[model samples]
Target: MDDLPRRPINKEREVDVNLQVASLLGTNGQWDVTKLIHLFPENEVTRILHMQVGNVHDRDVWAYSPHGSYTVKSGYTLATKLKEAEAVRDASEFVEVLELKRLIWKVPTIPKIHIERLNTRGLELDTCCRICKAAGESIEHALFNCTMAQEAWNQRSLTDLLTAYLKFMPDETIPFAQRKAIPWILWAIWKNINMLLYADTQESITIQIVHGMNEEEKKWVPPLPGYVKCNIHSNWRNAKLHSGVDYIIRDQSGNVLHHARDALTFSPNRVTSELSCLVWTLEIGFYFKDIIEAVKKPNDWPLFRALLQLISSLCARFRSVAFEVESSASNQIAREIAKSVLCDGHFQSYLAFGGPAWLHQRILREAAPISS
Candidate 1:
């Protein structure tokens, strides 16, 4: 028999050293401002304390001040209190909460396209959808809000699922966590929808949800309510989606936080031709949307105006390609009017993008807010 070598033993107590380090610098789970400050040297801490940026309070300094404005819980707005009601439907807040969740989870879930930019530029283009060329794409042009997505949602029984899931949630007034299940379910359904639209061919949303629910149930500690079906139709191939609008939102470091497809269509028949033409034209406009989102700041008004002109040119191009009709003279006039309004750059970015550009200009002219 060959001689066996003795295994060396660890005598330096590496595990104990690691524990000591963990105690000094909190673990990932316990990470917060105090935990972060403890890792810095006294001089560095002092420097941070002295660094002031006007009235904005620094959390590090505020931590030491006994009478600081920081509170464990902030007062809830009337809107916040109302959100708890299950029956109240506030689309704006729902979108905001979904965005907030995406931020919190560091997940790319919401569709945050530049609606203003898309409206300006996607007015023209000639690109056919790879899967289906019946329509092109733009911001307000995707699955959640558009017609094609509505078809898919109908096919997948999304409305029913959402309704059932929502029933289990706290109304508009409920806390986010209490209402989290529905959003999660919707998110999963949306993901499956995207998979069908982008990766797979002509998949039924219902089948995808059934399969998804099954997998989700296995992973859940306590299973969710809806039943999941496993046996998918063998003939249920994915549909070929030629053209669809999608939006991508990225962080400062160019990390994609959200991406969503608008819709996909295959119809280019005589009666539906105009609708398809309009849809396809929007693709050109999507570029402007992308630009707006990229330059998401207060000083991008000039860029926005340039985008409007670009949209007009694109729309004219698409109209020529599809209908052989000359570009709308009114659209050109609108562009000129837009330029005059933006000349001084004295408008709120949010309100500027919300209403009709002409209406916005009128408001500026009169120095008054418009009635709803």
Candidate 2:
């Protein structure tokens, strides 16, 4: 034991003597909070207490990859990112770029239009903007600089437009009627550009923009009689590593039966945050047996093995369960409720009989049927 290297209890602090991990465990094989409280901060103590203690021995696990196993592809990606970080003089700009990439995946626009750049370097294709025919056909020029695209965006630049869209569009605090049509406008511009270039047809950008905006305001459909629907949404913050899960259960008559919001810490990524939300819903007696069983065999997503197992065990209590994906507009209330943890500072977890008090009016309005 004396020959072995000692590990520090807290790396943030500099201490001459280090302690073994086993010293932190009590006689019952659980984390001894008494020892942790004396050595660590409150948040660290809480995190340590939340950790699961398995019967098996500990082993090495890779952190970079999702499956806790290192792969050459993942290694190369990490290496490239590290090299880029080292080369970039401005750290803030690099972080902003990384955040932009993360947000790009979450946007629900057409996939083809989401390409970061067009490869026109080696190709014999025309490099000028197809619509304006003035500037080079880069992503920025095509999306924002072109005369037609500028008209669609009201002459806003890409940075300003994206910033405004991300700030107000997805936020529930912004009234539905007051939200800008940035996403749809951007989509229409891309779509029209594609049609003109590929099909050699000139379509009215104004007409297409109107159609795209109207599509987002579609009414939510209720489930069939005798069946209930569950709408779930998760809000994740990358910087804080915190997540919030909000879910609403409604009957065929569009009446909300139950709603809940739970905040969690140390969520690794969006995928893990979503998986945690599903597990929370199941643990609270809202069974999704079909979906749970389907994901129980974690051959591909080994990072979620523990969560999947918990879900599988919970599913055994129920005979049948049904689930269907709900549109972002339909699930808007639930999504907002989840985001309230961060926005409204409601960080604590709670299971409520109905929708939250702050969003009571919005909930009532959404539950009502649209008069054709």
Candidate 3:
């Protein structure tokens, strides 16, 4: 061991309550002993605790307003203080309760099988696993258990591993369905943790995890757009894409109202069950024409074209409207929309117009004329 230096001792301690109070009050500090007495009273421990926790000294009494000055103000009762304290305690307890819940459940609640991150306490900890709540929330537990997570999983179509788990808890280590969906399980756990922490919700943690799993499946087996397998002429004319736009109508308290969603549709199909690719394309083209016609100025064309291209890319593989193959109703709508686009005065004067003419004629031949 290395030699250490010895310390000199015997310094006298001084007590100056005035100096302490002066320091707390600073030069501008004031005092109201009567108010402090009134606010604190004789029996209440709350005022003492508040002073201790807030570190308020005699001189610091100036921080309060004249009416407040540590006294019971007119509007604030002891009940108010109790409520505030309860709110604080409840908030703290809420998170603790969730943690306790995880502990009660046997879910993997930690770092991934391979990686780890620091916990809120700054200690290097495993990411949560779903299998054991005490372990930290992980994908496995969230998708399989924890009430809410289980609900989402059960409600939708389950994968083989999940299905096996649902049917019966198996012996040994691996189950029937999990081998193919391990990553998905993990991702769900992580996503649910994030949602729980940041979104301030008590949503089914398991359902969130399952959603993550579904998202993973969606990635592997990307769904084909409706139009890909649909009858092109029917579905496109009856698409229901217009409902997708949900404009904000009012503030949370219903104060001010605003009208949004000014953009016109490129296609206005009702999205029936039987639409085909041809109908889908027709809707797209017709919607595009509508947007172009709605514009008030020539310069807006550039912006409109850019927006049209974006819509096209987003809906590229989306399932288009479906209609009965033998029904001429959808067919006529498609023709009329196309014809209107072709004959629009704006298009004739500037934009070159070309659409399905034969299909339009076919639809007209099959339709009954209407007059006001």
Candidate 4:
């Protein structure tokens, strides 16, 4: 009303009053900017307040359309010409051992070949298999063809399991939990090999090869609407072996927006990978849309300097965000998903989908009323 001139008042007023009028809106509607300028120029304010570099987030999406909707027609147009302006900086790779491919991440196993490879660079050291002492060591020889390694594995109840895994690739056919047994057993075999070589024959380790696994049951809670929530979990299987991370994103209504669970075989450590989870989550969010509001985060993880730096620089799109941790009881679902990826031996990502069905069932069961 204040923005309109005295003469155009009635037409503007008539347009405002056409709430019940039979008219196709937006088809030919002409937007007037004078009204916005008079209304404190929020666009300008947002521009001035967010003028800093790296915070613009996006320029293609309409911040506020006249109709206040992201029209399908516009979306299609954007999609057609959408060579979206993007930049990538983190060149580091997250590696998985079971799904080995050509990559830079080092496996914890120190086979003869690894030593030999290093020796080529002038770091002279023993390049022979510690067990057989028959020839120069190699990843293939140490883990697979070595007489001692094969003998150790052959002695175990898992010999058939190891043989089968070596012959076939790990996939969905393998049970979620069963898949982990292979990796852990291999670690055991490697560890025992070292012991056998160094220890005296009289004090040799008897054939008691044992492995221990722990199970946990926890519940996950939904976030409130109008905001987004990201759940992250991480694990380090062997101190000298590997690490991995998992994360999930949801709207305030608890509907999943995105989810990813993967093994980080190359990751430096559990804490680093856990913190990297936050950085990757924030990076993904910023990659698609601008961050506006943040919610509570648990305080469980140590506030490492690298983690803090990652958040400040990568998540600069927002004015504010909170970091906190939740109770372990409420984190069961996410934990399960992370463990699944580690066992499944792959990285999985999904968008606009529901949470894991088994987890949802457990949640619903707990919420159900007891028999009267």
Q: What overall lDDT goes with each candidate model?
A: 0.34, 0.67, 0.35, 0.50
Predicted candidate 2 versus true structure: per-residue lDDT over 1-372, tens digit per residue? 112223424635665365666788889877888888888778667656654443344556555775556698777767767666675655766787767876976878642344332342222455557777874476677777888877766643334636676666677875564355566667777888878877888777667766776767765677787877778888988725568788888777667787888787766567667777887887786433323333644555554565666666766776666556666787788889889887878888877776677878776676666322
Name model 2 segments beyond 4 Å from true.
Answer: 1-76, 79-136, 139-215, 238-243, 265-268, 286-297, 347-350, 370-372
The TM-score measured for candidate 4 stands at: 0.34
Tens-digit lDDT track for model 3 on 1-372?
Answer: 002212212122543334332333223344334433443344332222222111222222222222113444522544455665576677975766756654745456443532432343234544544334445454456656556556545544455455465444443355434453444554554565566655644455456556655544431111132222111222222222321121111122221122111112323222211112222344444454322221223132331232333334534544442223323333333334333432442122112233234444443332222110
Question: For model 2, what is the C-alpha lDDT against the true structure?
Answer: 0.67
lDDT of 4: 0.50
TM-score of 1: 0.20
In candidate 4, list every pair of residues with a backbone clash: 112-137, 224-252, 225-252, 297-324, 297-325, 298-324, 298-325, 299-325
Q: Against the true structure, what is each candidate's TM-score? A: 0.20, 0.54, 0.21, 0.34
Position 36, candidate 3: lDDT? 39
Instruction: Report the number of the highest-TM-score candidate.
Output: 2
Q: Which residue ranges in model 4 land beyond 4 Å of their true spot?
A: 1-221, 290-304, 348-352, 363-372
Q: Ranking under lDDT, best-scoring first?
A: 2, 4, 3, 1
lDDT of 4 by residue, 1-372 (tens): 112112222223234543311121123332234442443245443322221112122223242222113666655545533322111123223224312532432656556557666666456767666667867666667666787667655654456666678653456776645555566556655666556555523122223223322322334555554677677777656434445567767664555666666565444345555655666667766766721112223122222333544567766786545556655676666677777766766565544355666577754443343211
Pick by TM-score: 2 or 3, better one: 2
